[model samples]
Target: MSRLYGDPIEVWTREGRPVQFVWRDRLHAVRRVVDHWVVSREWWKTSDSDPGERRFWRVEADPGSRIGTYELRFDTAGEGWLLMRAWD
Candidate 1:
């Protein structure tokens, strides 16, 4: 297995379903689904509340699962991506 740090990873449902949620480097809860997605749009910005400024992958757990969504953000300034958020 590969380390889950600064590495490109893919997630899917327990039943082998296509994953469409986000992933971040934090403790997250599992909902109806579990997976990781990639997202990137803007990179050159100083604002913190900028929406879609940075690329991010959102892993949303299925509603029935009540797991949660995993979110990852690609930091152009940092030269890599990191886990940024998780839903519970």
Candidate 2:
């Protein structure tokens, strides 16, 4: 399948609770609580620094899908979201 500009990473939830992560219209990986963490830091020094918290997830997609394997970061400011990092 062709990758869309904004490749969708579906955050799956059950009973209104987050359960796992899906990538590119496929089952990518499950979200383990131990694999998730929270970080709070001051970005005031940077031009876009804001007071907020960030949630990080370690996701594993298909066995050999480079683009499929990625880390997603969710921030509180602007309620923004990002694909913080990825690897093959």
Candidate 3:
């Protein structure tokens, strides 16, 4: 089963890669990165200042009791991290 969320989260990164994250007051360690991608249009060419680029990481993680896959999103313009989705 899978779930979706847009909750803000705190992440710890190493060399621009998420190594750990805190979601709903629990820490989840990133075991492996399943996929990585960027979602954005040609915002840089437009007059709008914000690039509107977002980076996404699909990762396998362990929260001590169980292991699951999660989708994490990083908003470059706002400099925030979000727990986008989770799988069990």
Check candidate 3 and list the clashing pairs.
none
Candidate 3 similarity to native, TM-score = 0.89
The candidate 2 region of ten consecutive residues with least summed lDDT is: 1-10
lDDT for each residue of candidate 2 in 1-88, tens digit (9 for 90 to 100) = 3222334455654663345555445555443333568787566632455667777765555523333445666666645455565555
**Alpha-carbon shift of residue 3 in model 1 (angstroms):** 23
Question: Which has the higher lDDT value, candidate number 1 or candidate number 3?
Answer: 3
**C-alpha RMSD for every candidate:** 10.3, 6.5, 2.2
Per-model TM-score, in order, reads 0.33, 0.48, 0.89
In order, candidate lDDTs are: 0.45, 0.54, 0.93
TM accuracy, model 2: 0.48
- Stretches off by above 4 angstroms in model 3 are 41-49
lDDT of 2 at 21: 59
Clashes (N, CA, C under 3 Å) per candidate: 27, 0, 0
Candidate of highest lDDT: 3
Q: Candidate order by lDDT, highest to lowest? A: 3, 2, 1
